[model samples]
Target: MRWRDTDKSSNIEDRRDQQMASAGVPSALLMRLLPFLLRTKIGRIVLLLGGAYLAFQYFTGGYSLEPSNTSGFSQSQSASNGQLQDENAQFVAAILGTTETVWNQLLKGRYVDPKLVLYRNMTSTGCGMGQAQSGPFYCPADSKVYIDLSFLEELKKLGAPGDFAFAYVIAHEVGHHVQNLLGTNAKVRQAQQATDKVGANQLSVGLELQADCYAGVWGHYVDKQLNLLEAGDVDEGIAAASAVGDDRLQKMAGRAVQPEAFTHGSSAQRIKWFKVGFASGDIASCNTFTAK
Candidate 1:
């Protein structure tokens, strides 16, 4: 968690100043029926089916998409915003530099590095239109990671605080990029397409947990090689993992922790897998696919 006294990464694009909005089928399109997805049992089933159908439709040209490669991915941000933009940009850049260092070393001669994009409100990505509300996520379509710093405020409210928590957030998203490079994400996507709602959610949970494990592995690199731990940094990471667990989110949303509804793994599972990765620093240790 001791990330200071160094230079910032050039790969980050800070757009924290933009006055942007969503370009998707606006909330108005599903406002009335949206609550049902989080409410009724049948609603969740319908929601998953609708998502699958739409994905199929889009795969068949329901929406025109531009095929763009991110081999030389670059960051773009508006400088016309606020001080928070600069502050968060530096914070994110430093963490990304740390990840790049670890992954570059771990992958040795093989892995391809990914770019991280920092934006406010909303932005267009190779995967699709990304918004701040979804938290931080990696778009495999573009091989770029997107983040909204506002999520930090929400994190503190969820009982997860400190620099390591934010670092873990970035690491988890970057873990998706790692998955992309390793082809785990593509396999998951294929399974998601072929499976039913309940089974698919199980696969999604495995994928998310594996990302958590990868994030933990990143921490191992920083802690062992970079000497970055400052006492309670690991605790901060665990707190964040707990805060964002499916059970905790379900409770916060006033719903039951339905096993079939879980896409991300439970609090204990996330923490356990992350610890495994941190302890081993070996990708082979992250076989959440085979773990019970």
Candidate 2:
């Protein structure tokens, strides 16, 4: 948690001032088309299918309708938000720097450092359009991490407040980048395509749990070598892992806890995986797929 005085990464890209350019089918056109299509059974079915296709495209990084303009950078936002942005930016850079150091040593200098893109509202990414609602994510296609600083406030709203919680979020995204580097993501994608919906969801849960473990692995290095973690920092990270579990989020929204619908595993699974990596500090211990 004590990250302010640490080394800052140079791979940070600040796109906080960009503006999104509108493209693709407009929402108004869809609204108009929907009513007309709903007049007939066939038309209504076709419309539903088309909507589902669009949603799939949007989620899979294939249909970016908005591209951000790279015009300029400014600090014209709220003074308090501006201060938080500056601090969070520095804090994130420090975390990235630490990850670079740890992975370089762990991989024996073969680790490729990923760029972190800090944007506001929306932006164009290799994995389609980035939105604040999507939260923090790493784009394997771009080899970069995307985050909106406002998500820090949202994390606090989810009851996971503290610098270590924020660090865990960033580390989890970086974990995805690690998977990308190791070809684990490619393997998972291949496996997902060969499975049914339930099986695919289970595979996704394995991937997410592995990322939580990777975050804990980073925490292990940060605590063991960097000595930056305070007394309650591990608890903060565990709280964050619990907060974002698919089951926890579903229960929070007043929905049933359906195991087959979970993509990110349950709260207990997340905390368990994190603890696995934290206790062992070994990448081999993070094989969530083979765990019973």
Q: Note the Cα lDDT for every prediction shown.
A: 0.80, 0.84
- Model 2: colliding residue pairs: none
lDDT (10s digit) by residue, model 2, range 1-292 = 7787887787777777555422355544765687789999999899888768766776776654332443444322222223335777878888888999888888786689988888886666788767788899999998989999999999999999999999999999999998999999999999999999999999999999999999899889999999999999999999999999888899899999999999999999999999988888899999999899
Candidate 1 per-residue lDDT, tens place, 1-292, comes to: 6787544456665554443222344434555678867698888888888768756765676643221233222234322222323566677877888898899888888678787777665666887768888898899998888988899998999999899999998999999898999899999999899989998999999999999999999999999889988999999999999889998899999998887899998888889988888899999989888788
What is the alpha-carbon lDDT for the whole of candidate 1? 0.80
Candidate 1, which ten residues in sequence have the lowest lDDT sum?
65-74
Q: Each candidate's TM vs. the true structure? A: 0.79, 0.81
**Error of model 2, residue 34, in angstroms:** 13
Query: Which candidate wins on lDDT?
Result: 2
Candidate 1, residue 119: how far the Cα is off, in Å? 1.2
lDDT for model 2, on a 0 to 1 scale?
0.84
